[model samples]
Structure formats: structure tokens, C-alpha cells
Target: MQEFEPATDQLDEAWDAIQHVADLQDAWAAINPQGEQQRLDDQLDRNLVQDSDDEFAEMEVPELQSRQNIHQGDQPRCAIETCDPEITEEQAQHMMRQLNEKQRQVFNHVSKWCDDKARDQSVDPFQMFLTGGAGTGKSHVIKCIQYYAKKVFARMTESAEDMTVLSLAHLGTAAFNICGQTICSGLKINPKSQKEYKPLGEESLNTLRVKYRHLQLVIIDEISMVSTTQLTYIFGRLQQIKGTYTDFGNVSILAVGDFYQLPPISPPTPLCFPHDEILKDIWNPLFQIVELKEIMRQKDDAIFAQMLNRLRERKKKQPLQKTDKELLESRRVEENNLTAPPDALHLFYLNKDVDSHNERKLASLNTEMFTIKANDVDQRGGRIIQVHETPHRTTRADDTSLASYLKLAVDARVMLIANVDVSDGLCNGVPGIVKGIEFCNSQNMPIVVYVKFDSDRVGAKTRTTQFIPPHYAGCVPIKPRKESFKVRGRTFTTTREQMPLKLAWAVTVHKVQGQTTDQAVISMKGLRKSMAYVALSRVTHLEGMYLMDYDESRIFCNEDIEANVAKMPTCDLSKANPLTEIDHNTNFVIAHHNIQSLHRHIDDLKRTQK
Candidate 1:
């Protein structure tokens, strides 16, 4: 019998090594189960000591351990090949280099862990979390990781081929475009009705399983926008199709997005919860955690960046200096009221002049253009104002009154160069040219308009009609109402119903929640106490906030304020570690395999042609 006591230092090193080995094993099992188990068994068998020894036998243990480690570490990396033309190797390298030191390290760590597991034939880590503030290069880093994987696949393949890299955005239209693009490129399907692309369902799965049973990764961007329910659906579908061949009974998912920004909107449920709940429910155990710290966008504006960071922290406002107070007042004047007469601000205040004699009041606010003087003297103010309008008359019951008002406002200012705010079925702040207008009723009211907007594909021409209520008279049959609207010297028909009402720039705090302005006129006087904090936080500097009859105490003392502060996630990056060599190798292998599969398919086509 041998009595062996491992030194404390040696024990610590051994434990670290074992933990690393275990991580690798877990990743390997995810990719290649049979191979992983066999390798583990072989290592155990080789490491088992049968000889009985004296007091010096402990010295032999370290040598035996080293042999076992070496034997278990020599397996080939797992490879995944892609066949999509969207991503290139040079592009991937460029993206990877963009990552900050901390992010790069974390990526490398995950890659190594995945690679080690592949070598050991064990389950591979399939999920990862990349957390950071705005401008932290989180999105950029994830894109690089995706590109790197694709590039590695291309490089390792025998025949040069591209890999499938689907990059989905978090919002509307973008989501559809991403999925459509993937289907178009990967499945060779057209979206047009006559040439509609139909997924082959089980057949497609079978083909993929036969050709790419060793597929390595599926990277999903904007993961924060995806609900757990949606994720479960995606995973469930993958599990059903890939079945046993799935790396972890599904594809290795790399989801990247900021959790703080707008979260998933569907189902109207909260996206983020307490850390404990997140860890237990939303956080996948296989996910390797990585937090990026460097602020890339606002690096030059440190003070502005700090203000944003503080805003995220939900810090209370301190007393402001005189200059700050002045700045705040200026901002309030700019953001809260309509720049022109009959502004939304006037509507808010219900000014008698603006409400009773709208036509006369709006006519006097003529458009003027002037530049600031070079001499220190201030020229007439050159501030831009936003106006919102809603039509008073309804042409149809279903017609959106807001749309008619927006069209009328835009038409009124077609030549004046004023920014018009139209709260249509589009994302806020989406700007487009007002191309043409058409009258819908006998009164020559403009109901439908044509808009040409730029999209990923090309400039799309879309015709949107304002929801008209039934009471409004249809276009008068006796005579066509003639109105002049011009864009680039092209005259278009306009309607008499179009009123030149000034729009007050007003958006719910939630809509403008994450944005910061140099100055803001926040109107929280009548709003619920819960919403006051949101309105106040919209400004960057304390001086930027213009309080319009706001209850300072209500905003500062609201229960929601406390809740928001308590709910804010702590963003500490001091404890993060760098990625290991094994991670890089694993990522390389997965990329290689994916590219190889695609190349093989291309080669088969060539052979058939010959």
C-alpha cells in the first residue's frame, strides 16, 4: 500500500487543470458523444495505478497524471463548413481584430473550451452571454466571432467554399429580411408568390443530417430581443430535426445583444428579471459568460458617456449650477413646445389663440432660414422644431386620424424644410421622402400617399393610405380639387383637407427612453409619478432638462424610481478572464468542418457535370 500526499501548490494546479479538462469534456460531449465517452474511458484506464509502493510512490503520481492528460488532449478538432457567399475570410479577421482586449479574451476562452471538448469527444458548450453597455463593441465582437467561424470553415475545406452565416437584427422588417436572406441564399428559394420557396421540412433535415452531421455553430445576434419562449421554440425545432446528431441535442447557439436596450416586445412581458431568476430560468447552463467593458463609440465624449452610464445606474440628480439651470431651460424650450405657432406644446397648454383660430395662428409662423454669426454675437436662434398633427375630420371609421394629420403637415412644409413627425405604423424616427399625394374623397382630401424609402434590397415604392372614417364625404364628383406638392421639381396632387397645423414634438418617455439630448423640455406635470423618472432621465446633463411645471418631488420620490434603480444590472468587468488556446483551436475545427461540408456538396455537383 502507498501513502501519497499531494503538495498544496500541486493540488491547486491539478484542480485547475482538471476543471479546464472538465470544461473541454463537456463541450466535446455536446459535439461527439460516442467519441467523447470512449476517450474518457481510455484516459481513465491508462491513468489507473495498479502497483503497490512505499512512501516515495506519491512522486510517481504526477508523472502518471501528465501521461493521462497528454493522451486525452491529442484528438483532432471538430470542424464545421459553411457554403454562404455573404461572409469572407478577410472580413472575419478584420472583425475579430475589432474586439476589445477583454472581449477577445472571452471569445478565445469559449473557443478553446469548445475545441478541447471536441478533442475529448465530449459535450461542447453551446450557449454564451456577451453583456455590455451601448457603444461597448458587443455587437461588433459577436459579428467578428461569426465571421471567424465562417472563415475557419472556408480555410480548412479541401475546396474553397463559403459557409452559412445568418445575422439577424432585433427589430421588425430586419428580422424578416434576415430570415429571408438566409432562405434565399442557403435554400435557393425565392420569396415571390409564384416562385415561393417551400422548406422541405423533414427531407431538408435529413439531407442536412446526412451532409452536415458535425455542424458546429449557429450564431444569433440580438439575443436580448428574443424571448425565452421563442428560444425554446427554436431549440425545440432544432432538436426535433437534428435529433441525436445535434451537438447538444441542438445547434451550438451564440446569442449576442444588450439586455438593457429594448427587449423582446411580443407577448408584452418583461424581458429581464432578477439575476437569481435569470440564472435559474433564462440563463442556459451551457452558456459561457463574457462581458465587454470598453466603450467604443463615446470614447471621445467621456463626460457624455459617463452621464449615460450614470443614467443607466439610476443615480439621483444633485443640485445644478446656474449655467446648468440655464442650459436646462433652453432645452425645455426646444423640446417641449412646437417651434411654430399652434405647436403641440400649445395644445398641451390649450392656449386660446392656438386652439380657437388655428388657421390664422399657423399662417403667421412663416418659414425663415438664417445662420449663426461668426462674430461672438448670437444670431436669431437656429433651432429645429418637430410638429405633430391629427386630422379633425374622419373619412372612414377605420381610418387613422393621426395619419391624415401627418400627411397634411408634411404637405404643408414640403417647401419649408421643417422636420415633420408622423406616428404611423413605422418605427419612430424613420425618415423618408414625401414623394406624391393623392386625393381620396369628393372634397379633394388627400387619403393615400406614395413613399419611396431605401431598404437593404433597393429603394421600395410603397403606397400607404390614411385610415379614413365613414362620415367624411367621398371625393366630390363635380370637380377635382387641385393642390400643389413638389419634391425635386416634381409637382404632385395634394388635398384641401391638409391643414398646416404645427406639430408639437412629443414622444412617450419609453419611446425616447435610452436617448440623450443636449437639451430636453420634459413635460411631466400631469403624468403619473411612475412615468416622471423616465421623462427626466431623457436629458444627458441636468442643465439639459427643461421641467415644464414638473413636480420635482414626485419625479425624485416616485416608487418606480426606486424600483428602476433596484432593477438596474450591476455592470462590473473586473473579474473577467481571457480565452485560452484550446478555445481558438476548437472554433477553428468547427469552422473547418462546416466549410468542408459545403465544399463537398460543390464537388459532387462538379463530378456530376463531368
Candidate 2:
């Protein structure tokens, strides 16, 4: 036991190793319960003190306890002076009391799901699929469930690590809102090409086992953006890592998103493909589906909400009423009013237009401009790849990855591309401007971009360590990682060291989903029908939108995926159906329905939300 006690930094490492062994034991027992103990005893030798040929339990905690200390750890790392602490469950409860009936029902269902998990130690976690359109409180419900899940697990488990849950999403912005990370980053799965993914490499398996063996739950936001191939890749990697054949390695998965939202960006996508391939692959026997019926985002504007419903349902585009239609159309017709709305983002369908708008704004401001070259060096400080580094697909500029050449100007509009500090309100998609800059005292090169996000000042680190892009045709480093600047507030620390800000004067509509603004003008060309609804929904009211022109094609989208997903067992809820009965005595926890009331309550929620 004395020999097993390692350095402080290595405590979790040792614990993780033990956890992996336990994972393997569980998997082996499931396979052959009669002889698993002996088989495990015979195969593992290094550091494993097992009875020669028959043993099921071991005394390992005393070794880790030989040197144990606990402190209040900040969840989201800040880049500056104070550590940003997570909201306590008590605080979350106070906020949750604000949810309407439909929102409350969703929370209650998730609470019971997790509560059942706490009561049963032998049963695997039950998977949950929460279906809702924008403003149905999908994101809000996710936070509430996360809060309650943590509360239940903390009470039931002795080991804090055992109660841990993984919160993940498909993209940085989506992940940021939920205080999570990109699925690609969390699963350590490469999204470069569907054909090139290899889940069973020795080092890869070892890495996955070490990182996720003890994790019991996963919550994925923006399931709409996740392709079937990506889902399969995640499930496959988890199975290999945990040595289990169960979907998600027998871990419970809670997926949240709108089925009719924008389809995935790549292949094997629109997960509801022919023959229900995606459902069969990742969501099946244990999967539960809950659909939210409320349109909380526009609760205050019922007529406008109805207009949106018509757009999504592809109803005959009827002429607007004399009052609202004239005001909205006049706003569109008066091109001058659309040109210079204060604090309005000029949305576009093409990158060229976005780039052109950014260039013009930069030129007009004529602020002091500075550029920082990324540091891509080896252990000895020698350049690794001198030319452009195209990170598989995840890190490429074309596919939402950071740019190789990032030009920054003081007073320029920018968005945080990563979760720099979650507790301090520094999240992905948070817009800000470079208030000032600091250069190397001697080198006279830009070192820190002093950014004012809303109000909090954050220093964006320009160089830090990060995951290296995987090469398809060449041998990659055995470790396969790189260095980039990261914001490490005094409270938390992370290995990621890359600058997290990107220019945001204008951006693609896809980049703006699930976000709202005071005013926005969209160029509807080149966008899908669903994309139009997503873009249109971002504006709170008709007065806030300035459409360059509307085309019939803009409101039509591919319906194959929607039709496929609809066939899955579903529980839809609205005021008419009422979610009241199911909250208490419903095993149909998989299907929940509660469309938010499209009343005046929305404006109140928005005021409190900001």
C-alpha cells in the first residue's frame, strides 16, 4: 500500500488505472459470470494483487487514501485573477422555479430518470432523447437535469469521481452554452473522414480507457448537428475502451436537439436515414424520446410564433395581416433602414460576403491592426510544419476551426470560439470587442488581446498547447498533441493553450443558430429552408428582422430525416394534452410533451436571462 501511494499529480492517474481494471472486470463478468474472476486474475499481472485464480474484489482505496485532500474546485476556468465558480444546486433551484409548466415537466422527468439511476446500482443508465424546437427550453432543461443529476449522484456515491457526468455538444458554441466541450474533443474521436476513423489502435484504446472508464453518463446538446457516423464512432470507441458491447458502453446517454433543425454538415448525416440506421446503431432498446411542445422563445408574440410555425410546416405562405405585414415588409423594402441598424449583425449565406463586410468594417474603423502567428514547434523549439496546417476537418477554417492567420484590430467585433471562462459568462458565441492590446515589451509584437466581453475584461492567450491535427496518409506523433495559448484563470487550469476569439462582425447563419439578437439582417440566398426558420427565429420580433429578399425556396427543406425520426416512439405534449399526468406516475418517461405558452411571459424570461 505504501508503495502504491504516488505523487499528488499521479493520484487520479492511479485511481483511473484501477477504475479501468474494474471496468474490464464488469465487462468480463457480463460475458462469463461463472469464470470471470479467475480469468481476470490470470490475465492481469502488473501492479494487480489478485488471488491467483479466483477473486472479485480488491482493497485499493487505502492506497489512494494514504494521501488524500479535497478542496472546492472551480468548474469553469477563468483566464484572470479570480476563479469562476459554478452555480450551486440551491442557486439553480431558485432559477428553475421560474420555468413554466411545460419546462417544469421536462425537469421533473429528467429528475426521475436520474433518481432511478441512483436507486439501482446494477442497472445501466437509461438513455433519454429530448425533442424540442428552438425556444422550447431544451438548453434550459439540460441545465436543470444536470443540476439534479449531480445532486442525486453526490448523495448516492462515496467516490466523487464515480458521480461524474460528461456534458458534451457537437460544436464549440453549442458546447459552451451548456458548459461542455465539443464531442470530438471529449471522445477524442477524429472527425476528418468517416472512412479513416480507427477506434482500436493500442495507444488510442489506452487513452480512452484512462480518460472515460469511470464516466457513467453523457449529455449531448445539438444532436441535430451530429451525423450518424459520428454517433457510431463515439459508441464504438466507448465500447472498445470499456470492454463492453453495450451502446455507449452501457452508459446512459441524454441527447437534446430539434429533429427538424439544420441537418448535419457531412455524410451519414440526418441520423434518421433509411431503415433507421442511426437509431439501430446508437439509440435502440433502452432509448426514450420526449418531445417539448412549447415555443417559449416567442411566448410573448403569439402571432409571430404562428408565422414561424407556418414557415416550418410549409403552409401556404399567406399574406400577412394589414398591420404586422405592412410594418415587416416596409422594413425589408426600406433598404436604408436595414443598412445601418445600431449593433445589428449583417448575416450572409456566403463567406465572401461575410469576409467583405468584415473588411469594410475594419477599413472604416481603421484601428491599430496586429496579427499573431501561431507557434507550431517541436520539443526543441524547431518548426514542425512551416506551411499551412490543415487540421483534419475539425480544425479547418472552412469547417469552424481556427484560422492559421488571425488578424485582430482594436475595437473589432469578435466572438469567443472556446469556453474561456464559463462561470464568468465567458462562453463560446459570446460577442465582444478588442478594447486594447498589449505587445511584447521588447519584440513589439502582439501578445495579449485585451477583450471586453459584454463587460468583463479577458486576456486572450495567443499561444498554448492543444490537440494536433491527425494526418490521414502519414505517421503522426505517438503522443499526437500540440501547444497553443490558453486562458488559465487563477481558479482553474487546462492544457488547451490556443487563442479563443474570432472576428464576428458578420458570420454564416449556421453559426448563429439557437442565438438571439436585438436586430439582424439576413441575405437568404444559398440557405436551406430549415436554415431560414433558424435564422428568422433568431430575431425576437418582426421589427428586429431585415430580410434582403424572401424566396419560396428559402422556406423549404429536405424532409427525409424528419420523416424517419418521426417513426421512432414519441411522446408529444402541449397545453391541450397536458404534461401534468405523466410527471408523477409515468414509465413512459421517454416521451414528454410540453409546448411553452406563446404568451407575454417570454419578454420577462428574456429580461431575466440576460
TM-scores of the candidates are: 0.44, 0.66
Q: After superposition, how far is residue 271 of candidate 1 from its true place, in Å?
A: 5.5
Score each candidate by Cα lDDT.
0.37, 0.55
Candidate 2 worst ten-residue window by lDDT:
59-68
Model 1 C-alpha lDDT versus the unseen true structure: 0.37
| Candidate 2 per-residue lDDT over residues 258-306, each given as its tens digit | 7677667654256555424343655544456787777877888877776
Q: Write the per-residue lDDT of candidate 1 for residues 251-341, one digit (tens) a residue.
A: 5666665554434433323234433322234443345556566666566656545544533333235443444344334545444573422
**Total residue pair clashes for candidate 2:** 21
